[model samples]
Target: MRPTRSVDYRTLAHLRLPPAVSDFIDGGSGDEITLHENTAALRRLRLRPNVLSGTGVPDTSTTVLGTPLATPIAVAPVAYHTLAHPDGETATVRAAGDAGALTVISTFSGQSMEEAARAATGPLWFQLYRFRDRDVTRTLVRRARRAGYAALVLTVDTPVLGRRHRDLRNSFALPPDVRPGNFDADHHTGLRHASPGHSAIARHTTEALEPALGWADVAWLRRITDLPIVLKGVLAPADARRAASEGIDAVIVSNHGGRQLDTTAATIDLLPDVAEAAGGHCEVLFDGGVRDGTDALKALALGARAVMIGRPALWALAAGGGEAVHHLLTLLTEELSDAMALCGRPTLADLDATLLAPATPVCRHTTTARREAP
Candidate 1:
């Protein structure tokens, strides 16, 4: 398929999947105001162009936690890849490896950690959703580390699953043959059974997740593996500062693609504030509403070390599996280079808030060396 833009893949994915399944992938939490705003806020930020500065085709390579990326984009962790295609995380990993981008494997990944790791030709970070049982959570972490994952990305926003009306309307549940390749029958029982009018995903988390998951638990996680710990789902500047002050390696400024909240501030709007709060403390990454390279460039100028593609990657995976995902990222990086050259910022080092219109605030970065995984 000659899909020229990211939305084309989204359209193709909608056509490829069942209506209910597509909605499950596409829909956000109640009202979805936050979901729509995530992208809208980025579009609202006006970029100022610079005159000829001798900048040619821009260089897009950068490092996150000491790992190199061909571009500043990483594949965000989205659940149930096999639900899109049978290859699941294996295909996704291969695509990311080929593009020289990072892949964060969801705890609920459609394939086993071992399988995903084996398929990876690039660095991998495991996104952890801690279970009520410490042992179960610990096991998943050790398994990921053993599988050669680079870091642990603990999702802290979801104390409880949010209300997704689409799942309720569709009564979405995993097909019998497809289950998270990571968990055994004992811990993931809720995933296997679906009740009418309720999403199995909600049931699974309600039954197994730690609703009172707190900062203490984060400390506990820090104690066990010694992997570089990155906190995902942060939107508040105070929370960003706390994470950095507490010795967390990185914090992703995100709103869970508006899937977890109905009316929270858009990630792009919050990024500059969060970046400022965590200034020089830890690397600030971003993960909301990144559809193209220009959107990525805006996020970088706002002080994100990198941006992650969530639904966009899933849509690509659904439309054409791994190949589509690679092509989409390649296009995005090229666009980013084009944008950089146009803005007189030929390299990532040359990006700063001055490239943005006066309405936007500038965020600065000061990063220290990251601790390697043991």
Candidate 2:
């Protein structure tokens, strides 16, 4: 057998991650209907080129959550970076900082939030998983604020952890050895098997996990922290509208990377209506299946102020550690620039629905109907 050459870190990360972690991050709930749809939605978008529009070296600079980002691409918060590499979130933060992109540190990181924040050279946003424990949630928010985080990303989609079978089949545990560094001491508990009737996964996720979180919580959060709050996991237009009305600084159109709800609407498929409902009321960002620069461009064209990449970053980390993650980000930046020049989009603002032709109609009427109902 030929030994694997030291190819690009991108390729390496893609290969290094264990099947269990891959399935956990990549797999969707029952049937993975939405997981497949996220990628399928991307395939259905056709880019239209505006030739001779004087690209003159396209600029990828754009602002997200009122902070100027070198490019509109941010790394999505994926918990337990240590699963990818020993260095964990620290390595990921370093890579993101070097690439001038933002890294949203997961509340469940292997490295403490402070350490990750200190490691990050670029802007940082702390992703909060509001547990049933309001105190824990509040402590995290306060810590993030003190750490100089630019924003607070409340992942509203996961009131309860979604069905992910890989972890179940793998009988995955946090590997008693690998601890979530940021978790308060009291949060730790003994392991329990995931059973069909009892949603072991949901039960395992932060116990005081607030399922009752609503726009009212957003209002409460605003009073507690001055950091701009961006609500992630919003796929419906009405929810998007409600978020805007509740004074959210931004709305991330995501389906929890297709890990939460199985038959949920694809984030890209739902972007148009959500954006329309948003109507410049808030900055609209996107996540879920954004694998490349072109994918980022396509999302921008559909009205996303920025895009977040999930699995790819972890794959890169797993394959080649921090170096691989850095290389992948560089590749994506270069690719986005190239795509922008080719599409004649001088800036993110230049990308719009005009640059894309619907390759196939993404059926979103059911979600839309739900939004319109009394």
| Model 1: lowest-lDDT 10 consecutive positions | 365-374
Measure candidate 1: CA RMSD.
6.8
Error of 2 at 345 (Å): 1.2
Identify the candidate with maximal TM-score. 1
Compared with the true structure, all predictions reach lDDT values of 0.87, 0.78
Clashing pairs in 2: 12-319, 13-315, 13-319, 131-208, 131-209, 132-208, 132-209, 133-208
Please identify model 1 stretches exceeding 4 Å from their true place: 186-189, 360-374
On a 0 to 100 scale, what is the lDDT of residue 361 in model 1?
A: 38
Q: lDDT of candidate 2 vs native?
A: 0.78
Question: What C-alpha lDDT, on a 0 to 100 scale, does residue 45 get in candidate 1?
Answer: 76
Q: Each model's TM-score, in the order given? A: 0.94, 0.90
Model 2, position 241, has a per-residue lDDT of 90
